[model samples]
Target: MNKYFLKTTLALTIGFSSLGMLPGTSQPIEVEAATTNTQNNNQAVAAKADQLIQTGKSLIGKSTYSNTVYKPTAPYKFSCATFLMYIFEKNGVDLATYNENYMIQQGTYVTRNQLQKGDLLFFKSKKTGTDPDHVGMYIGNNKMIHMADSKQNIVISDLNSKPYYTENYVSARRVLPTLMSANPATKGDKIVQNAYDLKNKVKISTTNNEKYLRFTAPGFVEYVYQKSGVNLGTTNLKAQMNLGKTVSRANLKKGDLVFFNSVKGSKTPSLVAIYAGNHRLIIPNSDGVITRVLLVDYYNEHYITAKRVF
Candidate 1:
């Protein structure tokens, strides 16, 4: 619908072996639920980029394209690069210029393969050159959103959807680490905020007929984090432990993922909890109830690691 960004299906086509392809649709690429990202930094970067994209998407219907006016607030008007610049500025990054030439020339150069969410993608306008004149923000699923031109409104386009972009695409730049530094509410903060809000809301799934509680420890953590926009992918315990920045037990934060070696059953780190701060953690107990437990001797003796995945 017109409510969300990218109302129309882009005419993009590519071998989405990495990203998943909908059963019948070849042009529409879906987020690969199977192609899991293991690196915590990538997850954090993707989360931040997705958040920025969602925020920018909220402005789609309200803005228009203009080369002369580069305002991003009310009655927003901007050219392709200016539009992207204004969006980044709104998201706490000041790129310092609305020009695409400098836009492509500066920032950390991201290879086509290493592109992450929130990366600035620049492309040639008329012909290939040293610097591109058009730009867009790379959202996940190989899609990017930008101000097309004066005749077109802001829209989402698949990187492979249009020949122009595929052929003219020059480079990408990342500014998330810098942005995260400037913003106090880090990804971990957002992740924990979502967890606390869902503490009471998360319930045992009624559909699954498993004998144990509605969710396994890893399943619960994945669900809570996923709802907050970080896809923890698989529900396997080892996989969950593999996510996020590993931290020492001494450096645990509010949202750090705490893993405990199996004291009763399962393998090492059989238990997991969401750090609730003040030396406390909330977990789904075997009694099928969510409760707060302290980092006592029992937990410390079996403690594994605290992961920071935002």
Candidate 2:
């Protein structure tokens, strides 16, 4: 047959003969053949691993790695860890046993050097030792994929590149299957098109008043009331409240006033407003004034459920 198979067969025949197991009998030869088959199977597994790594890289910004606890669309969206789950799943690996939180916990407790292609990566405010605030997938070669904070979008980043990732570098864990049967690759255009298509299928609206402006989603509305002038609490209030509603739900235009609230346990509110895609939202919270977060940030497990109030 193939050269690899022939070589493996020859190697096994010699090994069995040396052990005195292969007498001048047909049965001994049959045993050697079976042993060769097992070696070939192991080699095939190694090849599959390499192929899966390449597949993961191709899916970089296109596939969703994290689960959308509140997905308004199908095929679903992913976060870092969830995206890794998808990659592993596509390759025939099963990880239904672990959820996002479980994966994050494992990543934080594990060491960096132990990371592999399908492991999880996490990040957070360097000043605060709180929960792993952000998550991503470990795709080997010191690189990771994440739906980065509001500004970055879904992307691949160098593990040691950004100051936050370098200094606050957490942990990584390997949980993918040892072998995958099929591999599918993704491209950037397909990802953008998918996101755009989803956005178009949904309904979005915007409204304005002399003092306040707002955008509406399927079930939620975000409003921004003018502040006499920008202040710390007022700034953060503007951002955290209407972060997602504008771009995602209302398709906001320039010069809009985004609003925020200072309610405790309500670090982030259900609705927010926007001034243009460029003007960032700001609000006062336990951690002081925070600004410039995406609308999806309101859906972070840490924040309250988002509702439209246009």
Candidate 3:
């Protein structure tokens, strides 16, 4: 882990009080927005959170952290709190807080069991002293992405498996409503468009023919989502199924992940697709390219849960 002293630098861009929505003090968070009257607004909120997570995850290994300088304009070390401030403000959230303690308390507190994707998780550390000295964003399940320290930079960790996180874990809070950009539903639409955009770009190929690799069944599915800023983690059918929020088939949305139990009549999903609004889903044909399939009979028969990963 990278080490940092509790020293402040004059180059720090934001103080604890200078944020989009300052609560008490410390770090920054995506504050809750007023309840929206339209489904579009709700979609917008989801879209923004999805984007934030994607953007944050994408920054892993690229961002550096420091206890001194707080230049968030890239090429600067980001402390635990300033790292979040940089990510939020960089992605249109407009937040500027840099105190870990102040940042975690910026949203409504939620129980551990009630935690969802895009929640702010706080931890107290000797390095930070008082309040929350360390912070991270809950991605999904028990996984989180945070700036570990000066050595590790940005990384993803399993909250359930890590003893350090479990010991220091203080609370989780909801913070996505305010960070939303306009037309988040468009993110889903773009994901759909990404699938179609590469419809014929790839075709099924095996190791014997190394060139047509991106055109494989699972590859097609993963590539489409990757184009939209979300990585499904792996191309394995079963592994991919466990990546996002599992939604009922009846509740499938445009970007919902649809799956099917195609072999041995297994109860688990064996194949997957991107739900494309209406009754259609985008899947790979035998050639390993994008094809539209309807959940009419065959798919509806083998359909499993639709997971909303983004």
Question: Backbone clash tally for model 2?
Answer: 32
Give the alpha carbon lDDT tens digit for every residue of 1-310 in model 1.
0011311111011111222224553232334322212233656567656655765676576678766544544566667766665455444333534556655644578888888788888887665346576788888788888888766678999888879888888788766653233134556656655554454444545332224325665777777777678887878878888887998877877678888886644347767887754454666544332433343447767777788876
Clashes of each: 2, 32, 12
Model 2 ranges with Cα > 4 A deviation: 1-55, 60-76, 97-99, 105-110, 126-130, 176-310
Cα error, residue 150 of model 1, in Å, equals 1.9
Top candidate on TM-score is 3
Task: Give the lowest summed-lDDT range of ten residues in model 1.
Answer: 7-16
- In the range 197-290, model 2's lDDT, one tens digit per residue, is 2222223333323232222321111222212121223233334344334332254333233443335365555444332122223332222222
The residue ranges of model 1 lying beyond 4 angstroms of the native Cα positions read 1-44, 178-310
Candidate 1 residue 306 Cα shift, in angstroms, is 41
Candidate 3, 60-146: lDDT as tens digits: 655687776555444546776666765554444433245555455555788888877768888875655456778888888788888
Best by lDDT: 3
